[model samples]
Target chain A: MPLVDIQLIEGVFTEAQKKGMIEKVTDAMVEIEGEAMRGVTWVRVQEFRSGAWGIGGKGLTTEDVRALTS
Target chain B: MPLVDIQLIEGVFTEAQKKGMIEKVTDAMVEIEGEAMRGVTWVRVQEFRSGAWGIGGKGLTTEDVRALTS
Candidate 1:
């Protein structure tokens, strides 16, 4: 019901953590994207190494990013 | 944060439609699963034939399911 296709970058978050992340991400998208909450959905989650997908090019595993203070 | 790995099977829906699904799914997970909305997310949307996924095993494409009544 949400975007048919989507790719997400997530890290370190445990199963519970991931669940929470999805909830919030969806809420934000609905608020910001002006989409119906019922229409929201989960697509895909991609794990990345620190330097692999973010700015600053720091070497951080998905776990590292999740644990990052800032 | 939220669960990091999740596999989702979704039926027919547009980009906006998918987005809405994510938002709602996340919210539901939060309410029922007691996870944070932020942790919920879009994982993977696998297009299934009517019979490919869901009950009755009816041969329905993703669209058929999305448009399904009830």
Candidate 2:
């Protein structure tokens, strides 16, 4: 089973967006692994509090993520 | 930076237990990599909904996890 865990800044995604992400991530894993893995694939979305998630020595906030993604 | 994600059955761990897990997992990553990596280490503990997480063709519930761990 391939378990995918995605971490992002809190409040960046709505529930619908997260659901889409889970489906797409699982699909990607199934495409690479095999169709049999589809039933066993698990995707978890975790939102980190501001200042808790850091990249390149800088903490990421929702605004930072928005700017980077948008 | 190493990101460690732990997946488990929901309701299996208390807040304190999860906190301890986060600390230990981060420490393990740091030990394997180096001391400098500790600052950027991210440990996310995810609890999957019952009947959603499967292993070896069987779904895992809190009771199953408790039995296995105990």
Best by lDDT: 2
Candidate 1 C-alpha lDDT tens digits along B1-70? 2332222334444566555545554564445334433443433334433455444655445555445323
Candidate 2 residue runs with Cα over 4 Å from true position = A1-6, A9-70
Q: Supply candidate 2's per-residue lDDT for B4.
A: 67
What would the TM-score be for candidate 1 when compared with the true structure? 0.33
State the lDDT of candidate 2 residue by residue for A1-70, as single tens digits.
6789987778788899999999999988989999988998999997765544544234456788788778
Q: Candidate 2 on B1-70: residue-level lDDT in tens?
A: 5776677777787766766777777777777888888777777665678777888988888888888788
Cα lDDT for residue A5, candidate 2? 90
lDDT of model 2 at position A42: 92
Output the TM-score of candidate 2. Answer: 0.53
> What docking class should model 2 receive?
incorrect
Q: What tens-digit string does per-residue lDDT give for candidate 1 at A1-70?
A: 3332323344444566545545565664455335443364444444544455544655546655444423
